[model samples]
Target: MEGGSSTSGGRSWSIYGRAEITARYEILGSVGSGTYSDVYRARRLSDGLAVALKEVHDYQSSVREIEALQALHGSPNVVDLIEYFWQEDEDAVLVLEFLQTDLETVIREGKRRDGGIEVGEVKQWMVQILRGVDACHRRGIMHRDLKPSNLLIGADGVLKLADFGQSRILNEFEQIPTNEEWMPQPPTIDQGVSHPSVGGYENQAAQEQRPFNQEDYLQQLVDFKTRYGTNDADKESNLQDGDASCLATCSTGDMEDDPYKGSYSFVAEESAEHESGTLTSYVGTRWFRAPELLFGSVSYGLEIDLWSLGCIFAELLSLKPLFPGTSDIDQLGKIISVLGDLTEESCPGCSKLPDYNKISFNKVENPIGLIACLPNRSPSEVNLVKRLVCYDPASRATTMELLLDTYFTEEEPLPTPLSELKVPSTKTTHDGGSLGEFYNYGNMESDSDLEEFGPMDISTTERGFSIRFS
Candidate 1:
């Protein structure tokens, strides 16, 4: 679908209309854009309620997103999808409850001001996110890509889950593809010397060609472990020294002195049964990928989402992404270095995973030692993070548990509700121009003309849209 327009008339209408639904909400300006969609701030012509409109590129993907939204409508913790429509020419428009800003933006801005998000505020948001996720889980939906960017804060201080593009409806027979096609096959080893063979008792000498570099294959396995496996020496040093400042520094976005900068060292080479270009193979953003996914586990589930939550929580606290790995493999290394390693015994079905055969690690690392990495973090905060980021899906804390954690309850109270936050009702006038002048309907022939522009000319440039109440 084409993006919304930014005309002054469009803005006024968006702010004042009450019962009117139009081809476009009339974009005040671009809010955000991704590979497949663009989001804009708009208003309902009927009620004048401000909303965000997402215009998607692919009809099928848009349909899927709408289905996810339909499943989440009426959910207090989810951004409400009020309605959606397909214009005459197949342009899809989804009207969403508007949010003031996203969590990532808020956290980043706070960092620039040298201020940290209040611990209490963090807890409140965490609770809201969990509430939304819990609702989704009850409906058998998994938000595969749960991250800070997807969590938005309304002007009234309400937190809601926004993006559903990567979400999936889970069921008994969900057809998750395996990763066997993505990983390289292990080289075969020769058991003995080849002997003479004959098809029909006629002597014929045959020599085995031998499989590709077996030693090199073994070395690769060793390298994977050495790089990703937790180092006891490093852990012990941190424990003995009790130097958490270094760890805290790692959590922040400042990466100027980081060792693995400007290198594609994180993502491990793996082939999927599905091609890389396909939607399913596109794992989440590198910084937020869970350990199982980073390690190439094919049968992974919602625990990955929890892992991302843990990372986001850490980032929120530190004003940076928790593990800023340049590649997938490196990302795994950062996780292991901080949270320790996972073994077959701990992760019971791990070996059965697609990339399990490629792993050569023998022992799992200790979880307690890993907690020390978050310098100055309270025990309650660490406990919550660990519970949310557990390797075992069953062991991972439910969203409800996270919401009720003591870190939020004892540390601080929830922020004032968004409805009570004092945001200006109108944009500031510039250059002595009155705000009403931009949307002055002086020469407007009829409301019908604006509504009858068809699908192609729907555009707006106004700062706000108007909705007239009866």
Candidate 2:
């Protein structure tokens, strides 16, 4: 959106389709910074409303976050994007709803409590998280980076999902077009030939045309992938011939060759040339990263988010991280040490992951299960985590399923009322005057924290700061 000249005297600044940012809102102070963006707390001049000004430096990240927010406009559990500003030469600025604290702070707050967060409170947070995740997954969007720091809490004690810069629209048909005016129109088809169905050709004139149901289509694809796993040799051929729309609308990674290769492939095959079409494996915080991602699997799906959800739940139950690894290799080692050996029997088609053969570890004779990770937790609570934190991506529980599980379904420890839930303030400091790691927007870590990790691009860099739980 373009803007006119501002009321200010000197330089004519156009911002947010009206006056300059300084004219519209009073900048309070800087809150957070990341590789691609800087966040500042601001107050709208007209309404005196508190909002976050996220000045995005990276062009691609700006577009991604904007698109994702636009697509998820009315989701109650997702963060609200109030407005944005983008000009020819200057950087893009997003005006978001201001949130006081995050889930990380809530978990820390719970630690100080007599017995940690109550069961009902934990269930409430999980319910909100699942609702947000289910909204994204149902719409064919992958948050890619789901962690405690990224989930924010407002004054009303409601949790909202945030930090969408790393999000992606997986379905090609559902992709939002940048400029519809510039988009090429599809060619007209002949009237005689009928569109091909999953199995055979159909006579369009003879049959009643059914309206396209994306939800049903996606569910079928999930059921198909779950049963077939990644070992079906004819999977690609079947998708190509029987249902071309499935590949375009439902497929996640490379179906035939490497199941771990992302759909955004630049290279068709494994060759001497630089690896093409490979998504950056290092996208999330090390503590909650999925094993497939740790093993450099690019062609992942919503399952990665489920794994992170499991980690978050475990922390809520125990008031500590389930696996706090020092590095990527150590992260995998920690998971292996708990879940036993990573094998084909444990996770079918796991060997197909790009880095499965590269990373090796000694098999644990007696692996400590999720129960050990969450001591004193009830069987239902532990079972809830086990449903998601597993070796197989397909085996991981979907948000819908988790919401229906006995842990959430049972009436005893019900989700806490919103008024009963505690909400921490962002201004709250710990360890004297130091600010907590997760009390700001954009969910970024300082450059000094990642200096030893080597240079990386905005998309590939480690996003969240790690809190090593001894």
Candidate 3:
């Protein structure tokens, strides 16, 4: 991971308390750059082994990514972390096994068969994605920002999960329902003057001023945890313990007989370090986001990733975004147009989301389903897609369940081996996908003569640029 006696191409670079950076590796060229870091392809000076160097501007993000990647080093579908060294006081450099390109680039550059990738290739990539994500979830981690761009591919065509910047560690054994602020308890009459009420405030309704109240929402949320929440049996048992966190007046037998051995303290006592932010709304790129996230549920779990996997699979199969919306509101509308509408009965606790009650959507009666949209795909394939993109987050397929699906296991259309795929893996990002923010053709700011230009006018207004790609 570090220095040898080898000299790096007649130049010298240095880091704090370490050997010169140039002494270990030869900088090849730049790959890409994101908000926090720049990716580069480099070769180890000692053995000439190719490696990817990510020069990070933010130390906090680098440390968080290092912790996550180190925890998931051996997973076949995940990227390998080679080593890291400091560049400056607030900057650090991460060394990783260099990959050729990413899945997004493959989809963009690969020829479209019937307007999508070959069904076999899509299956191969989807299975690999689920396996890599499973590795993360099994280890109690969640890749919060899972999209095509972050999923890298090597020359051997092995898909690796990269970019741990937005990942989260979920310690279920120690976690409470929501990280919320506890109200100051009223004093007792024993000390000095007459303190208002002790046991009284606990029974009263919460004031509307509080953003989230344990008295109203916390207890209600516990009551809403039906048998259908998580797809995993083991995780389901863990969620049952979540009930004990809210019920303060449970019988002595109920408290003693709890399966978790009373490890779960009250939800109120848990620290308010919940979602990555103080108030978790949406944190991912808009298109791949799940319904629960759109509804603004801060208490959502790993199933949200499953929803994203569904969207990715659809994009791979159709060679276009499944639900590309102009904004958050439009995104939700597009989802309903496909999955129908959501009600409290449909998703059970969806209404409890912070923003759920804030907006309303039209109910779609005969919305399009996966089978019709992916007409080229087989019935089994369609079923898996339906399960993965289910309206209820509780019902989406877990990574383990997805691996066991007949569509993947059966021999109807075997997955094309990675080495056999024709697409060349090279350095790229969602292949000009950044143009999405700049060119939302469906909802451009300026008006156009639709009769004269039609839908293509959004991108082709200036020239024949978009028509050439389409």
Candidate 3 lDDT tens digits, 1-470: 12211225422232222345566877866565555565667799889999987766554456567667766655689888776664333245678887766777777765443445666777889889998997776665667778887788887889989887666665442222222222223222122211112212332223343454436543443433343254333443322111111122122433354343244333222222242223222245667777767654545566778888888888787677788865454567678878777776667667655445444554577988676677677677677778889867777767766776777778567788887875554544333433221111122112222122122212222211111101
The parts of candidate 2 lying over 4 Å away from their true place are: 1-19, 173-278, 427-470
Model 1 lDDT per residue over 10-80, tens place: 33222123123343354565565555565667765556788876666555456556666665555678887
Q: How do these models rank on TM-score, best leading?
A: 2, 3, 1
Q: Is candidate 2 or candidate 3 better by lDDT?
A: 2
Candidates 1 and 2 compared: the better one by lDDT is 2
Instruction: Estimate TM-scores for all models.
Output: 0.60, 0.71, 0.67
lDDT accuracy of residue 468 in candidate 1:
14
Q: Highest TM-score, which number?
A: 2
Task: Please write out the lDDT profile of model 2 over residues 1-470, one tens digit for every residue.
Answer: 22223324332233333346777788776676555566778898999999988777665566678777766666789898776766565567778898888888888788788988999999999999998997776666778778887898898988899988777665442422111112211112222221112112221333444454546655655664464333332332111111111111111221334223242223223221123323332356667778876665535666778899999899889988898865444566689889998899998777765546543555689999888988898988899899989998878888877876767877677999999987776634444233343324222221112223233222221321111121
The TM-score of candidate 2 is 0.71
> What C-alpha lDDT values do all the predictions have?
0.50, 0.63, 0.58
Alpha-carbon error at 79 in model 1, in Å? 0.9
